[model samples]
Target: MTAVEETQQAEAEDFLVDKAKAVEVEVPDAPEEIGRSDYYTAKEVSMHNKPSDVWVSFLGNVYDLTSVVSSQSRELESDGSSLVFPLIKCAGTDISHWFDETTGDIKKYVDPIKNMMTYYIPQGRFVHVPPAEPVSDWDNSFEVPWWKDATLKVGKLSASTRSLRVKNVLTGHEHLMEVPCEETVGQIRARYLEYNAHAASYTWKALKPNEEKELVFQNLDMTLNLQDNGIADDQPTFEALGISSDFHTPVIHLYYDDDLTVA
Candidate 1:
């Protein structure tokens, strides 16, 4: 070949070599395989030796692994055979605080002051239940009790009169009377019965001073006498009767001639 052609061929070969070096081939990531513990491998993950800060997703809710412990024995089924761990325990941080230095086992703290306000799943492990399909029907066809129609009226009284007016619109009854501006809630109950004789059997009481009662009054506007008692003045205008705030709302007991039974 001619000298010029040979030089050109040499340069082309060098160019091809540099081009191949410049091109990069990338390796794709392999598909992830499910781990043996992830499936039904019969291997149990023990929380006994785990750290107190480990979080566990149990029964669809995330829980502090250190707050609970497993007490009961559980069996693992693998390859048609059952493997039993009689004393295998899983403990969380809650159990960590009660750790016994002597036995190396967790101490049960049942009445934890800090956990009183929180919900706990107790120290036992539970099987997870799959979620079911939700029902879409939202219409309620059931009839409510007749006593639900009753309501109470609450309002504030003028300072000069020292009297408040409470009315039960359902029975067409009105109670207008004087009350001690500083009267306690207990005294208000007594006064309620004094002015309204019909209220004697109904047992009407203030849930909240100067506030509406859960009994669902037709008119919430009513005058309250602050001078009768100071007890209710500082409390919520609306309050529930009974020691527990979770009790059912107070309702007026009604009697029908046909049944004559208090409903």
Candidate 2:
């Protein structure tokens, strides 16, 4: 090879060596507490697509890979950025297709020419993935691949989604949002904080009729979902009867407690 070509190859090898060293460094422990729902909607996961705040769902679980991706991104040489581009492009998205449902690992297929099984990465390999062929700088000493690391898992991706309408009785304000079906009332309130800063200071309840048919507000159990608190989602029943779901959206009324604790 020419002098210039040899120099370029050496530089690429150096970059890979640096990356291998970085990979050996241990990642920080996952947070002690998430203080959020155990379930997440696809919309919620899509909001954190940036390298500085990336999240992705695979095999029904959500993982926050922001720290790892951001740290590696900062170390990338201009010419070597493409090595991690697949991860950046897939941030805040569901990548369940890339993994095997039974094994919960990246999918593999037989190599056409080599007649051997190999990892199938159509988007190109990213960090922690071993090279297709052995190289001088390649490292596989890490105990676990990022995809198999449980420490990065944050929550489960909700299997189903539902629309909820939360109305503030004191301020006459209302916000409609999509929520995970598996979330509790308390978790839902946490999600509501984005719309109302004082969501926790409000008394959440639902209006229902007594034996006399007079409507009254009943306090909700924060630990339970609407159905468990006596407000079931009847949208499916309504639709089965040929009624539009929009005609009967479940509404949760909130009464402010006049607390100033939360700004």
TM values, all candidates: 0.19, 0.72
Tell me how many residue pairs clash in candidate 1: 36
Candidate 2: what lDDT? 0.82
Runs in model 1 deviating more than 4 A are: 1-161, 203-263
**Clashing residue pair totals per candidate (backbone < 3 A):** 36, 0
What overall lDDT goes with each candidate model? Answer: 0.32, 0.82
lDDT of 1 by residue, 212-248 (tens): 4343322111232233322223222323332442232
lDDT of 2 at 197: 71
Indicate the TM-score of model 2: 0.72
Residues 1-263, candidate 2: write the lDDT tens digits. Answer: 99999999999999999999988845444312214678989998999988678899999999998766865564343356645578879999999999999999899999999898889999888777777777776556767888898999999999877788999999999999888888888888888889887687788988887679888988888888777877778778888999987777888999876655433
lDDT of 2 at 216: 92
